[model samples]
Target: MLGRLFLKLEFKKVDYAELYLWLGSLMKNNCKQRRQFLVMAAGLLAASVVPAWAAGVSGEVKALEGVAWRNDQPLKLGDPIMLGDHLRTGADSKLVVRLGGDVYLLRANGSLQLENKGLVLGSLRLLSGALLAVFAKSNKQIITPTVTAGIRGTGLYVEASEQSTYFCLCYGEVELMPMHQRSQQFRFKANHHKAHTLDAKGGVEKSPLRNHNDDELAILEALAGRKPHALVG
Candidate 1:
């Protein structure tokens, strides 16, 4: 199972004590800090009321652990998540959400905006952090700080920051390009291969694989009711 695979891959931190200690560090200040965070998010949402309302029920939180927030509120297991919702996960948190036929796993200290325009997902922005995504047979695109990836029924891992974005096409097919240079696009078809870095200055450079494995892909794919097509490296 992918979950089991992730656990094994993370064996370097096999000491449960260390894992718990790391998670403990993510605890927010208190309810006061949470309230302040929510207030600020609400203020920003108010500035874009039309878009927020357009977000309808898209999925449910299949699994949630530790500190995670949805629409200015603490998330609970089985909580329904709507489109256009701004999601954030704190240190040592893990969230699994299924939207339409797409399954997304938001890791610790990550943030992203959810989206589903009518039926097709128009926009999903990973602001700062990383996520693992598995898509059912459909054309969907993911946006990070520097690039956009168009994928079809694929498993992908991504990390975004102001400097660059890391992309791993774990399996299936994906078309990638910089947000600044849409014309210069590339396609990748493989399982657990083809990793790259998209830089802020429109530089698409080959990057060595890091921080992911086939087991992670299997888990995300299972959540999407599919399986990764294991390929020879």
Candidate 2:
């Protein structure tokens, strides 16, 4: 009954460390059999709760490298990156942010402006530099100066500049369309990596994956409480 009750809890919102400490205090007052039951319940609770909690948390700074900024202020670990925030990274810096079931890694010299629907981010604009992202099944889009990508539960890497956008569908599917000619659109499905270059004149050219890799995708996905679908079995 105790294990069942714990399983029914919305544990994502609970502080697990404090919960464990409280359980420890209670166990000290119980007999051996009750203590054993509590230990068992704790194990079950942890296994069920962690993934849910990680997937449900939004606006969390999961990792930061070198120096980064959020809304023009110096960024720190564990900072809450709210929806509609303006984010930037310094030269040689990187930033990782978790938004509900998705994770994004912004590369050096990147500038991003987030767009939100209520409290959740539905889309984002990469003003300059590069970004790598993974998403859970949702209606999400990424916009750049030269192109826009509508993604559905996919892994993507993009670099944006004034003239062109380098886009790589790391895995899964994406609909890529040029900003200048929205009528020129194409869907790409990749099991590994499929690369393209979108020019300002609305030309799509096939390219090679240059800077990102599977290992980096795995790392970001793990932080979002999942594994790359290719690595899962």
Candidate 3:
């Protein structure tokens, strides 16, 4: 079993630090659990490796539950996620993907479109759904019907609809611009979660953090072979 797992993991590569972290977390487990951890680590290691790409494929699905579609075709774990693809999740579904060093989680009943400039994700258009993501330090944007957010190396969560959008800058910095009122745009930095809502009329309002947490950010960062701020120490 361990050999098979290793062979499977050979498809990708992970950082040694990630391996050590995983080991530390599971060191207290029983023998069988330890084996299970090895298997899971093998998979994670595979995901961290940059595979030889097919044209336009810049990433792959790391975790998937229930049903998902990529460009209207059935999506599966380990499948390459290409640039400019449309991704959707069915009821009760969840999808996690890694691109470069970034990680994203899409919740049930969500639709998102990837916009890439070269190999980097330039923007994410949340057509209608909920998404949580952690990005490596870079300039990027998140777009919704009601708002567009310019972000720099941040962990973020958003839920979008035609009438309103909920946004949480989980960490780092953001410049938020409401669709109907770019004149009212504002910028802020967040050491922790900071929440807001944008309405169709180009209004921005303070909102309470909801539907996301630091633990989820940690999970996403781990999948990308990095640590969240809270776990850095």
Among the numbered candidates, top TM-score falls to 3
lDDT for position 227 in model 3: 48
Write one digit per residue (lDDT tens) for candidate 2, span 39-70. Answer: 45434443443442454545777677788998
Candidate 1 collision pairs? 170-192
User: Which candidate leads the pack in lDDT?
Assistant: 3
lDDT by residue for model 3 (18-96), tens: 3433444555556676655544553464356553243345888877778999999999767888789999999998888
The 10 consecutive residues of candidate 1 with the worst lDDT sum are: 44-53
Ranking of predictions according to TM-score: 3, 2, 1
Show the lowest summed lDDT stretch of 10 residues, model 3: 15-24
lDDT of 3 at 168: 90
Pairs of residues clashing in candidate 3: 13-49
C-alpha lDDT of candidate 2 relative to the true structure:
0.76
lDDT of 2 at 43: 45
Per-residue lDDT for 1-233 in model 1, tens only?
A: 32452353234322222322322342434645433333332333223222211345567776666878997699986688777888999998877777776778888998989776785576678998889877778777788889988888877889999889999887789888888887888888975678889898778778888876554454444444443343122
